[model samples]
Target: MESKTTKKVTRGRPVCEIKQAEQKAKLIFSAKQLLNIKSYSQITIRDIASEASINSAMIKYYFGGKENLFVELIQSIADEQFSQFEDLGEHKKPVYLFIRRFGEILQSHPGIVHLLSEEVLNKTTPLARAFMAAFPARVSKFLPPLIQQETGISDTKKAKLAAFQLITLLVSPYILKTLRQQAWQIDDTEIQGEAWAKDLYRHFIYGLKESNTNEVES
Candidate 1:
């Protein structure tokens, strides 16, 4: 149907394209699963490609290698996170429900805290510093003021601190997980663990009010 040179080039491109797409998908899936279990330093391009069943070299061809892949993964997660926030922002979700959602998000994306803790929050990497710089501004815009508006806390400082404490409560599970990995094993997402989290959430919320609020405490 075409000249020899043209046919060779045309056929080659499609094969390359298909291979590229497969490699990309493999890397993405592998990263997501591995991220849930290990720290970033423990993750390698070779490991990802091997897990994805592709040549390690293919990772470069498709995702521009490990750093870009990590950035892309963060962006994908941020997009999904913002979408969840948007959905919640539209509803008058109960305080404990909102707290539970924060925990659930962190639980499902355990790697976020691990990475953020190691890199940005820990001053371990310049890349983490860059990510952390914008994180507070972004989170502040949506969380604290929103909490104040919802709970009628006119004190801006208190509202912001409350929001941070709430996130800390949500994040406590991951912290516990990291600590326990050194010795004891704890599953913060388990029913017993979740009940404790709810109690803490309710306990903390009580302090944000004038006199009365949810008495549910851990």
Candidate 2:
């Protein structure tokens, strides 16, 4: 019972949406490639558009501006990393599971730690504030339970400290990747493999034992 024009418009919408999604993805990918070589401040719209092989105006059309695009890219990376954590508690060895999944993310997103350090940890820009607003709640909600389960820590403060230590242990390696390679010849693949995760879990759990026993006693 639809007119030809109405049917045509409905059919055209899906194709338009698909094209828009493709364009946005290209822009995002372009930004990511440029980010690997350049700092966030140094990457411009033209650079991204040139990388993407699209017109420069499309960057604004798709992402509003360069800053927002970068923030969204970082947010997407955080979401990808965080999504891997959901199944951690379900595993028998949650700490090992967490470390392995953490490695997977680092493998998939090389230089992600550097990007995060440059854009979020080292700055107080609007992009940093936006990312902080969106992600910290997710981290707070997810990490504490895993930490408590692994360490058997009943006190909130001690559990928090353990979580901080665990994160530091996981992230510091990647942050110091170059130094780790130069000093020890430990490549990223070795760190991102099951062998390293097992070792890290053993050391971390062993370290927790003294405190866990003391906490139970006192």
- Which candidate comes out best when scored by TM-score? 2
lDDT of 1 by residue, 1-218 (tens): 87566334432223666766766766787887888889888999988977887777766766677877877677666666656665556666445556666666676787787787765564745456545543444666678767776677777887788888777766655766667555666655452346866687567766677422432231
- Best-matching candidate per lDDT: 2
* Candidate 1 CA-lDDT value: 0.67
lDDT of 2 by residue, 45-104 (tens): 999989988888877777789988887887777876687688888866787787778777
lDDT of 2 at 161: 71
> How many Å off is the CA of 154 in candidate 1?
1.9
Report the poorest 10 consecutive residues by lDDT, candidate 1: 209-218
Candidate 1's TM-score reads 0.74
